[model samples]
Target: MQIEPFTLHVPQTQIDDLHRRIDMTRWAEQETVDDWSQGTPLAALRELVRYWREEYDWRRCEAWLNATGQFTARIDGLSIHFLHVRSRHENATPLVLTHGWPGSILEFRNCIAALTDPEAHGGTAEDAFHVVIPALPGFGFSGKPTQAGWGVERIGRAWGELMRGLGYARWFAQGGDWGSAVTTAIALQKVEGCAGIHLNMPIARPQPEDLAAPSPTEVRALTALQHYQDWDSGYSKQQQTRPQTVGYGLVDSPVGQAGWIYEKMWAWTDNAGRAEDALDRDAILDNIMLYWLPAAGASSARLYWESFGSFAAKDIDLPVAVSAFPKEILPTPRKWAERHYRKLVHWGDMEKGGHFAAWEQPEAFVRELRIAFGKMR
Candidate 1:
């Protein structure tokens, strides 16, 4: 693997073009709803557009991100962007931190400092770990795979290679959303290079044995799934079948992009009313900008269409830890996940974070990961 510096500098033309798209956006009519429950209410998007065009400053945000040791690696012919910050602790274990779809390397920015140097950040030196936060293939600075079948398993294998290329023989892994699925693949294969695994968004689809117990926890988990099937899966359906169609609106308009990203942030965070209360608005815009500048809005969504169905069928063999947040659409019960993971070690029902736990509550997320992996140690 060849490592090199990676940074973004959006040109004047692209910024102007983004503004024009924002100006020319064709608004779709919809009834007033609570915090974009109805697919990014057109009105709220329009307001967001104003801030994005006139108020938001991308260069400043980029500079702040660059301070965190930005770099790129050509892995399997894809250019992968990541922030690598190693702990000073000589005994710190190498850990891979992977992010999911509709997200970027930015998700892990908050936890990097604490995870890498726990002793300096009010944590035991024994809790330290060398953290590798990689942007998934095609989501950000990472190269977008142009062909098909580049699923979670492949990504997991790539991660294993990434560690070896960096001269590490073993590592712990953690993921959220698609990242969780990738961790499952790495763990199931018992990747000799991987030592333990932790996940936020479980990618193991339901199995008969998983639902067999019918315990209160299992029943509640099933109910969540049933509800997700009814009211929460519109984005998945579109992404799976015709991501290109959905991409057209998202790439062309800033408001459209904001709405697309905002709905997820709102639905999946530890927030009650204002998303800003939980997620930094600037962070949200930075993620959207990654999609907008690359025009990868559609290409990324195709991940769902291409690989999710098959990936959902396999079971993981390693010990796994899961943290479930209340507002998430289909949070699996701990007992249910234990069926797939033979060595289920830790489970947490979180009151403070949702889908993007790594971003919403960095302290809690890092603490959980340390505790989970520390047990394996």
Candidate 2:
């Protein structure tokens, strides 16, 4: 497994082509509703597209990623891309942070400097971590899986190998969204040298017994889950059922791709009312570029088709820590989480943050990881 250092450099032709496509976008009719009831509002998206074409600098994002250490390794017959930032603290615990669908390593970029050098970011050396942020197979710079079975379980196994390959005898895992599912899979598999795992969006589901006599939190959680299934799950359903069909538009039209993910950024983040409220435009664009530059729309969504139903957390006896973000698509209540995570070591209900916890709330996100892993460390 040869690991090679990587850098970011999108071909000029590709950038030119993106600009041309954005310019030639044949827009659809605007929604009748006053708000985001339908999807990304046309006016909002038009402004974003304008900025994306005229002002948003992909080169800056590229340079930022290049400055951060990056590498690609052949793992499980696939070329996996990851950002490996070692902490100055020699004894820092190794940690593998994974990103989910509609997300990439960009989600963790802001937290890297803080995590790897805690003292530099207002924390002690004890809080430092040697962080490894992997672009999930079929996302960002990672090679797309040509065959099936590159789901959460397989990704989890690959992450174990990745940690070992990087010379870490022991490590911890942290993630949210699809990342949470992958982390849970790692815990369930009892990956060697995995000290523990931390999750922002835990995959605990209300069991039949719990639904019979639900607690107040469980009732609220269940209601939210139902709402998600009814409304917000269209993207999941489309991806699970016909990723190839959706891929055509997303891969071809930059606007189509942006709209698909932009809506989620709005719906998922704790942005109060708009995505820009919580996350800056550049951060959001940086994330979108991960998909746009790589044309990973279909490949990223295929994980849903492969492992959506299989992601639920089961009874795992390993030490597990969970941080439940309030505005998450479906926040897992502590009581519900306890039912699945047998040795629930840490449970936190954060005041703010949502699906993109690391991106939306880096300070709180870093603090949670430090606190959660401190117990195991």
Candidate 3:
């Protein structure tokens, strides 16, 4: 349970090497269709790669991570890297935020200021939080698990220990994507200090009854879920089935890694056909850098291999809150969520945002957390 300071300092040589790899990429032929029906467009990827090689400054991102207060603590034989930003408000709640696949701790950068200093970010002092954003094992600067069994359930247990080690007797938890699975696992385990939990991508699959008698929203949700299964979940299938096979290319080529993630950025984000519409080029590159810098293409994918099926419904008695972003992978209804989360507290059908709720919409994300956790407190 010992905590130690961690600083991000990517060596100059390593950065230079990344530039070389991007320069030497052997790009494939462009997609047949003009749109993104096939995969990442060669033209778009090349444009992104051009910027990454020529102008994107890794050092700038490195400095921000350092200044944001990074730390490492050993738990379950792995050193977990996290950003611990404590609010000045004495009564601020301690909250643990988790990131999922194709994402890193960088996802929460914009959210830190608003959560840690609510007054400065259009909120009263009472809305403040002592935020802890942890990089999931095998992602970012966190130590990769050499052995197996480091899935969501184990991760949930480790988070409990992490908060306890940090001297947080009472706290709230929030997550999206795979993070939603972990936070739900924590609730199922009934982690002692966790007061309540919040989720942006609440994983509640539709039952027979739901399908038989569906509302307009439920019908739309069902259609979206079908679309994901039919078209969008190819990445998940590959990662969960053969992460190592995909890892070889991702780990070797910078463009390969970028293309792998860039596709999701385009598909998942709430944009008008381009990821750039929702997230800036620099921001997208910042996220891709985490995987590239760590060479975590394979290791990060292992979480899917280990816990792909764990996103199923579970009876969780702990107080739960959900924010169903419009373009989330599967925006299930409140009635569906209430089936699994017995003591549901808050349900927000957010007008905007997508799968990466916090990253895509930090203001809305912060507002959800403040309102959701505010109820429990």
Candidate 4:
């Protein structure tokens, strides 16, 4: 496999065009309700748009990514973009962190330094990790898959190969959302050199037998799942059934793309009132740009159409750790997770955090990872 160094330098003309679009946006009418039940309110989006056009700096984000170190490797005929940050500690373990839908490698940016240099971030050398954060195929800087079959299973296999290709004989994997599904697949397939896995959003569902005598946690989990399926799953449904249709609006309209993802950042995060409470305004916009600038709205959504239904909590006999964030779209209980992860090693219930664990709560995210993987080490 050939890996080439990559840097992000969006053309000046494109940046100018984005600003022009934001300036000329045909405004939508304000919502009747002051809350987010309908969707991203026009008032909030207007404020975000104003800030985005006048203040948010893409160069800052680009520079940060460049400084972090990035490369693109052709794996299985597709170019894969990833961040490779090696710890100075010689005994650091190799670990791959995967991002989910509506997220990119940017999600892990804040945690990288802390994770790779634990001694500098209030930890001993034992907690250090050689981190590899990859952009899922058809998202961010990675090449889009032109054909079908690039599902979680294939991506898992590719990750396994990626680790070996990078000269790591053994490595650990961690992820949330779609990334969780991919990580589960990696463990299920017994991917080469996969020592263990950790998940923030595990796909553990109660079996009929288990549900027959539901505990309080199981009941709460089932209720939450039902609520998600009823209200919060419109995006998933559209992405699963007709991604191209939704992508047309998302790719052509910058505001459309921003609204699509921004709503999720708000709805999913453990915020006091606004999404900005949990995440920085600049950070939210930065993540949206990863989709907008790359025009990845279609390709990214297609991953769901390809693999959403195929994901489940299959039994795996490997060291598994889970951090069950309370505000996740669907929080799995410890008992539910233990059913599928036969050799469960670590299980933590985080007080705060949501779907974007690494981005929303980096300190907690890093702490969970170090503690969880500590058992494996």
On TM-score, the candidate that comes out on top is: 3
Per-residue CA lDDT of model 4 for 133-165, tens digit only, reads 999999998999999989999999999888888
Clashes per prediction? 0, 0, 0, 0
- What lDDT would each prediction earn against the true structure? 0.79, 0.90, 0.92, 0.92
State the lDDT of candidate 1 residue by residue for 24-137, as single tens digits.
Answer: 877787757755556666666666677888899888777876877788888887777788878888778899998887788888888888998897777898898888888887
Off by over 4 Å in 3: none
The positional error of residue 27 in candidate 4, measured at the CA in angstroms, is 2.5
Candidate 3, residues 1-377, lDDT tens digits: the string is 89999987988999899988887878798888998879899999999999999888888888998998999999999999999999999889999999988888878889999999999999999999999989999998899999999999999999999999999999999999989999999999998799999999998888888889999989999999999999899999999999999999999999999999999999999999889988888989999989988899999999999999998989999899999999998778888888888888899988888889999999999999999999999
lDDT minimum window of 10 residues, candidate 1? 306-315
Better of 1 and 4 by TM-score: 4
Task: Locate the minimum summed-lDDT window of 10 residues in model 2.
Answer: 310-319
- Each model's TM-score, in the order given? 0.93, 0.98, 0.99, 0.98
The C-alpha RMSD of each candidate to the native structure, in angstroms, is 2.2, 1.1, 0.8, 1.1
Which regions of candidate 4 fall more than 4 Å away from where they truly are?
none
Residue-level lDDT of model 2, residues 1-377, one tens digit each, is 68899987999999999999999999999999989888899998998899999999899989988999999989999999999999989999999998888888989978999999998888899999999999998899999999998988899999999999999999999988889889989998998989899998887777788889998888888898998998798999999889999998899999999999999999998887889998899888988999998999889989888998876668887789988888889878887788888888898889998889899899989998889999988
Better of 2 and 4 by lDDT: 4
- Per-residue error (Å), model 4, residue 234: 0.3
